[model samples]
Target: MPLHSLQRLSPTVLLGLWRLSETPADLWPLLPRAEAYRALLPATADGKRQAQWLGGRVLIHRLLAEAAPAVAAAVQVHNDPTGRPWLDGPGAELTVSLSHSGAWVAAILARGGRAGVDIEEIRDKAQRLASKFLAPAEWAAAQAACTTAAEASTHYTLLWSAKETLYKLAAQRGIIFKTQLLLGEFEPRAAGHIPATLVLSDFETRHCICYSQPSPGYVLTYCHESPA
Candidate 1:
């Protein structure tokens, strides 16, 4: 019930966010133990990890419960070999992704396709390491585009979070972030909304990524990918 935001992207696809104000003990009752997610509940999990795991389950339940009780009751979340969390059981009809950053956690559920979501705390790092995750051309573009250190940092965070979302969505092993996942460079837009694109396999695959400042000092992005 702590879902801070929910966007009905489509009839069966939903994007949900939880502020993580509840502790693991508080969330335990809401999230009943199930085989799919039971073992994932780490005994040593602190608040951050607890929210990271529980937020996804709670969001799925609350989002589905909104439409119908039966629809909401089918969610079972488990991880694949890639360690990406997925829904199972009655929830198998949906493809879902979950991410947690700082005090916020995000989950995206698509009725007919896969979804990926990521969030990052904004800080200055681009000036120090843009070249690490970005290509030479992208680094040059970022330098030419951003006018200040603060702007450059936001650019770095956006690029980092964008690739992370794409990687999670792809769930493909052995792909390097800096080289395999390709993203174009653009000025970091602080106001309104800015949309970015991420490409892989030399244009064989494409995904649209949208950025939003869900809270001060944090960046959030989510993408919907169709299975190839």
Candidate 2:
């Protein structure tokens, strides 16, 4: 479909979502440096992957339209050595994070710092793998708060999605999810903020990550960090 949702999370942060219904041909027209970005994709990429890839840029373009209309049609998405995305071209002052799951793609753009976004399709897998990502107490609290199997699935998926968003914001390699990046006490809701902490060797930083269920089976989480 078209741009699904776009919202200003803060004065300098914008979030956008796009559903993957269009083919690569359809999405290419929505981007500015379409041919250049296409060349950056792996030679082995299939049509679905290409579509998802372009869908993220398309979402970003839409977000820029809302936040920085002057450069919305000029800047292109580029990746650094670590595979983190940023804007390139005239007035390319924003950093971005892109993510796709199943048939949904999401992006976050921040003017003065880093941004991270994650969208996940709710499934039983998150519940099955919760122990590996959630702390012992976190898993227990989530399980106790869930009254039904479906509720547990949504809760676990949000935890994983929230941590993924935090990880993207960190941009530091070799961090473990269960111990280093942790979510504080909270039950899943249709939409709300979750308290989270990123534990470094000698210090820690906390964040209030925002999350929402854009559709029935999907959960979206995003956060932005200002430059230190």
Q: For this target, which candidate reaches the highest TM-score against the unseen true structure?
A: 2
Model 2 residue 117 lDDT score: 91
List per-prediction Cα lDDT, in the order shown: 0.73, 0.86
Task: Give lDDT tens digits, candidate 2, residues 101-155.
Answer: 8899999888887678999999989899988998998988988889998888888
Off by over 4 Å in 1: 34-38, 66-69, 125-129, 185-187, 191-203, 226-228
Q: Candidate 2, residue 128: CA error in Å?
A: 1.6
- In model 2, which range of ten residues has the least summed lDDT? 84-93
Model 2 bad stretches (over 4 Å): 226-228
- How much is 39 displaced in model 1, in angstroms? 3.4
Best by lDDT: 2
